[model samples]
Target chain A: MIEICEVGPRDGLQNECKIVPTAQKVELINKLIEAGIRNIEAVSFVNPKVVPPMADAEEVLKSLPKRDDVRFGGLVLSRSGLERALKTNVDFLHVVTTTSDSFNLRNAKRTVDQAVGELSLVINEGTASGKGVAGVLGTAFGCPFEGEVPLENVLKVAEKFLEAGCTEITLADTTGMANPNQVQEVVNSFLDTFGKDLSLGLHFHNTRGLGLANVLAGYQAGVRRFDSSIAGLGGCPFAPKAVGNVCTEDMINMFHGMGIDTDTDLASILETAKWMETVMERPLDGMLLKAGIV
Target chain B: MIEICEVGPRDGLQNECKIVPTAQKVELINKLIEAGIRNIEAVSFVNPKVVPPMADAEEVLKSLPKRDDVRFGGLVLSRSGLERALKTNVDFLHVVTTTSDSFNLRNAKRTVDQAVGELSLVINEGTASGKGVAGVLGTAFGCPFEGEVPLENVLKVAEKFLEAGCTEITLADTTGMANPNQVQEVVNSFLDTFGKDLSLGLHFHNTRGLGLANVLAGYQAGVRRFDSSIAGLGGCPFAPKAVGNVCTEDMINMFHGMGIDTDTDLASILETAKWMETVMERPLDGMLLKAGIV
Candidate 1:
């Protein structure tokens, strides 16, 4: 069975122009959990001035339904975000840094090495507080500003994350510059370097419409975990020309259609995607939302 | 190198609510030629009343530039359409029939065997006139009305087409109901039966967002030719909930990004897709048009 992490609450809503209410965010999480999604990135503990939509991260986390089957994660980019998350009931902490210095500088206002150094402290603190820390390396495939980030840079960052006590590592195509061939190569390299026992996840953007194809490549290369957003929500505020995250319902539909068990209820998730469309008050990028389940 | 057949004019424009002027249709073909697309399904010779957008089929065929490097094709569903196409300067003829009786009945008002019987006569007539005949089996993957079309039915239709002097066979997922595993199975079966010399092509719809993924599977299974539409234009007017065909520029972008040669200039095709967006007077479904080349 493949695993999927729903990133709608945090990554999906963070870039929206309108701020989603803490209650609505909590409710969306409730709906996803109802759909049998166990792992969800529920909120981001960042500066409110930087991302106003995620200002109520603590409130949203506090209001979540307590379930042993569910895992709620919060994004932590720095010491401040980690501290804020530590005081909350978030089940996990997701620490992110890009492979390219240009992207890391723009996203975190620090170089790649500097951001790694800082996030290492954040990961250690979160782990010390008994939180499961997941390291997400953004622009692991390619960077918008730097064009092509070397695979070596990706490995270096992932090594640092492992050394800093990250329980999981997710490679993110931040601006959707990855193709299937690149995904296969990166996935194989990661598995070869870290061995098959390493917990590896893949996050993709649909900016260029390659999200699912990349997922298929990653799966074929023996990596199973993926990160997606409902109704294709969320683009990076720091990444120019970035679009929505890979649609959660659409990816689930692909998996179910392929006779692969995702242990997720597709019908329930599709209904939630439709509800998300109304809440966003706009048409999102999900194909299943428009075409329905085939 | 892979071959791409631009189907924007015939399959793409046929479903548009607005009637595109015959001159604009010719201009679109000219732009496609400028972008190095050699094979083009230029027009469909169906009843003008049934498909009003293709009312000027003869006029569109007559206005095309005569070039030795380009091969222009016309869609012919029946003996009447074949006769009409014979009167024009169309370089080749594309005869289509679905494997499922439910789809074939709705599309051409005939059963699968009846379509194969009548289209065999059309293929003979087109071949007699020295036109390259390509047999397109629509709903070869899955049908909107009939859930799953068996592989035996697909092979039966293809075998009939081959016996009728068809030079090529293109399997079409007319309603975007295909998965990657299914594509791999079908493509491998076809190639295994027909040998490497068989000219096999794939046509996919992006309704469920699996168009490119299916294309990847087809390619991995040894298919070298694909059909795509500019700006992802056109859906079956008869197929409920059907959306656009796979976008030409976006698919090309994927091929180019993977270091695979498509032999089509992406920048020029992107320019034409931008022009098509203005012609359609709405946002098209292509991702490259919105995100630009990565």
Candidate 2:
């Protein structure tokens, strides 16, 4: 069984052009939890002025129903964001940086080294607060700005976070510029250095329509955990694509069809995606919702 | 090395709501030939009264610039359609039948047995005419009408076609309900029963977004020939799903990216898809055309 971290509320809603209300965000998270999603990226601790959709992250976090078993995480880029998340009941703080300093500078307004320094602070703070920390290594496969990032660069950053006591790391294809062979090669290189037991995850976008294909490669290469948005929703607001995130329902359907257990209720997850589509007033890039669970 | 028979002119245009003129149809085939497509399904000999888009099949075939090295084929359902194709310069004749009796009856107004009986005449005529014959087994994976088609049923039909001297068989997922695992299982079963080097082919639709994924599995299971459409321009018009046919450009990108040789010029193919977009006045389902040859 693979663990799927639902990133619909934070990543999916953050990229929407319209602002989703705090209550709806809470409801989406609750629905996901009800559907057996143990870990959910409920909110992003980013600036409200820049990303207006995530403006009510704190309020949404406050409104979440108390659930002892369900653990919710928040994406935090800077130490200030981490400090804010630490004040909330967020079970984990997700630290993000890139293998390419160029993408890091453009994406987070900080150099890779500087971002690693901030990550140390976030990891330490989360450790002090007894909350788990996950490092999201963005642009780990290839960077739009830097073109091809070296495998050594990705592993070095992951090592930094793990050395700082982070629980796990997620390799993200920020631009969806990855193919299956490349995914397998990079995953093999990561596991070769980091050992097989590392709590590794994969984050992919359906930009080039190879999202599920890449996931299969990653699975074959031995990475088990994955991050996906409900309706295949979410793209970077600054730089978007046709769609972002592999549709959770479609991935679940494929995995279930193959007898690879995901432990996700496909019907409930699909209903959440439909609700998300209704709230956003737009059709999502998911095929299962239209195909009716194959 | 794999052979990708361009089906944009036949299977593609046959589904278009508006009629694509004979001149433009010829140009699409010519452009594909220039881009190194050796096999082109240029026309369908079905009744123009029933499928108006393919009304000019003879006109399109006559207008095609003759290249002795390049082979052009036409799809024929009935013996009358086969006679029309035999009268034309079509180098190969394609026969199609469905695995499900219900689909065969609805699609061609004939039962599976009746269709296979018709296929015998098509094979014998093609053999006498000295033209290669290929059988398209529709719904070989599963049928929308029959729910789940048995493997033995699929092979029984193929065995009849092969015994009648059909050169190769193309398994088509007409409804695009196939997943990678199912695709692998079906392909493996076909290969195990039929022997290796059977000249097997795969035709997929992007209806459920698993077209390329299925292609990957088919390749892994020893299928070297594939059917694709330019700009992803075809669908089962009677039962369409967001523009079907696995995008030829996207498939090429994936194969080339993975170091598989597909002896086709991607730049010219993409230009053709772009030209097709202008001609059709619509964006295509293919990702590489929109993503710019990642």
Best by TM-score: 1
Locate the minimum summed-lDDT window of 10 residues in model 2 chain B.
B235-244
- Quick one: best DockQ, which candidate? 1
Per-model CA lDDT versus the true structure: 0.90, 0.85
Off by over 4 Å in 2: A235-242, B235-242
lDDT of 1 by residue, A1-294 (tens): 889999989888986656778888888999999999999999898888888888898788778888989999988888999889989899999998889999887777889999999999998888999999999999999998989999998999999999999989999998889999999999999999999999999999998989999999999999889999998987543455658889999999888888999998999999999998788887777888878887
Please give, for residues B140-185, the per-residue lDDT of candidate 1 as tens digits: 9899898999999999899999999999999999888999999999
Off by over 4 Å in 1: A235-242, B235-240
The per-model DockQ list reads: 0.68, 0.57
In TM-score terms, candidate 2 sits at 0.96
- I-RMSD for candidate 1: 1.9
Residue pairs with colliding backbones in model 2 are none
